[model samples]
Target: MTAAPVEGELAMVGEVAEQLRDVRRHVDFFDNDVHQARDLAREADSRSLATETTVAGFARWLERLEQSNEALRRETATLRGHHPPDPQRPPRHRCSRYAPPIHLSALGEEAGDTA
Candidate 1:
């Protein structure tokens, strides 16, 4: 006979699904806003005036969205403890090639050493 799901387990699953849905909705909203901001920034760029304010506003919006996304991810991880791909650890593979340039002078090291 198949075992039935416990009340707490079912409740947790429902909560997780709801949270996942919320995360998706927020992501969609954030994406739409970002697209709109990009369009506005492009328009401002075409004009004589600087688009700094518009771009800054878009950056702020993106920051908030990123924060919310991170929080939701943490919450989901907590709900599903001991799952694969532990959030605390970094991935093994080198995902990207965009490393920030190191300033040797700032670090009190010779620039030649960095080569």
Candidate 2:
């Protein structure tokens, strides 16, 4: 009710208001820091997921390449065995003709004549 007491009450209220403002600024700073930390954590997790995906893709690609190489080796072997040499020419025949040569008893017989 008195003027001095009223002035004293107003000053006290002003100090309380200033302290509240400082507390609010500190809370805002802390909230921003928490949000930034969460964002960084999410980014790290996303990077880890991408790296795992890349590694898995590389593993699959390597497996396919190995399968392709094995298939090529099998095809090469099959191609090598597919052709048969001319049996009429004994010198040009393949090594599959490995039997022992039976020399002709008659002197008039030819080299490549099987008859």
lDDT of 1 by residue, 1-115 (tens): 2345677788899999999999999999999999999999888777735567678889999999999998887788679773446668886574453576766677765666867
lDDT of 2 by residue, 25-88 (tens): 9999999999999999999999999999999999999999999997887788578784443458
List the pairs of residues colliding in candidate 2. Answer: none
Model 1, position 46, has a per-residue lDDT of 79
Q: Which residue pairs clash within candidate 1? A: none
Model 1 TM-score (2 dp): 0.36
Cα lDDT, model 2, residue 101: 67
What lDDT does each candidate get? 0.80, 0.85
Tell me how far candidate 1 lies from the true structure as C-alpha RMSD in angstroms.
Answer: 33.8
Residue 4 C-alpha lDDT in model 2: 94
Best candidate according to TM-score: 2
